[model samples]
Target: MTVTVQPSPRPRAARSSGIGRLLIAVYAVLALGAAGRSAVQIIERFDTAPLAFTLSAIAALVYFVATVALIAPGKAWSRVAWAAIGFEAVGVLIVGALSVAMPQLFPEATVWSFFGMGYLFIPLVLPWLGLWWLATVRRSERVAAAAEAA
Candidate 1:
């Protein structure tokens, strides 16, 4: 019997594109802004609002991690993105409420204070968008894989 030859599979496409690229860009910008703001706040006026300044630093770290995670490919990076985005959402909510309910606690606003009012509420809204994007990407990938199998 003649041997049947099989063609090699093509390389998988990159996951980060379109809205994914937009998300990464936003995260990168936010990361830079937060990091710079936190650095100045911590160095110059930490004593004025320790809680707020510390929160700013934390927000910066989260943003930085999220930006990197969103850009990187692999399930591990996706998990990191999930964790960072979720934590950012919670931080925004808690800090926003605290800043409003007890203004005394925050002599100065953190990046997340006022639900990220300073950043046009992007902090408040971005996480949900990111989560949705992640879910959509996962679903689409699954559908594609199923279709390929069939």
Candidate 2:
């Protein structure tokens, strides 16, 4: 009797073609939204709700960083993309609850307020979308690599 062990599948390290571009666009929008809101919050009302503004600033930084990570073409970028999106998912959920349950605590709205109602729920949805986009990127990259290998 003969036994064979198949090698495990490899990790993906590149972006999809068209889908990658679309993901980049979505990330770009997220980055823009977060950055803009954070800027406003920090500049407009530093004394009113410092915590909320600080969260917004961090969220904005995360979104922009995630966008850059996903857009870059490499393995390190994939790792960064995963980290950023995961953090974003958690941030939205936590901030959403806080804003809803503790309205008084928040002097004004942040991006993740009311489950991202202000951004039309984009903040709530973008992380999931980003995961999907990254998956697509990985799959396409794998297929392309396989084709080349073949």
Q: Clashes in each model (backbone N, CA, C under 3 Å)?
A: 0, 0
Off by over 4 Å in 1: 1-15
lDDT of 2 by residue, 22-137 (tens): 76787677778778878887898789888878887887888778878877777888898899999999989999998889998778888788888988898898888878878877
Clashing pairs in 2: none
> What tens-digit string does per-residue lDDT give for candidate 1 at 55-122?
98899899999888888999899889889989998889999999999989988889999999999999
Error of 2 at 103 (Å): 2.0
> Highest lDDT: which candidate?
1
* lDDT value for model 2: 0.80
> What's the CA error at residue 82 for candidate 1, in Å?
0.8
Worst 10 residues of 1 by lDDT: 7-16
Best by TM-score: 1
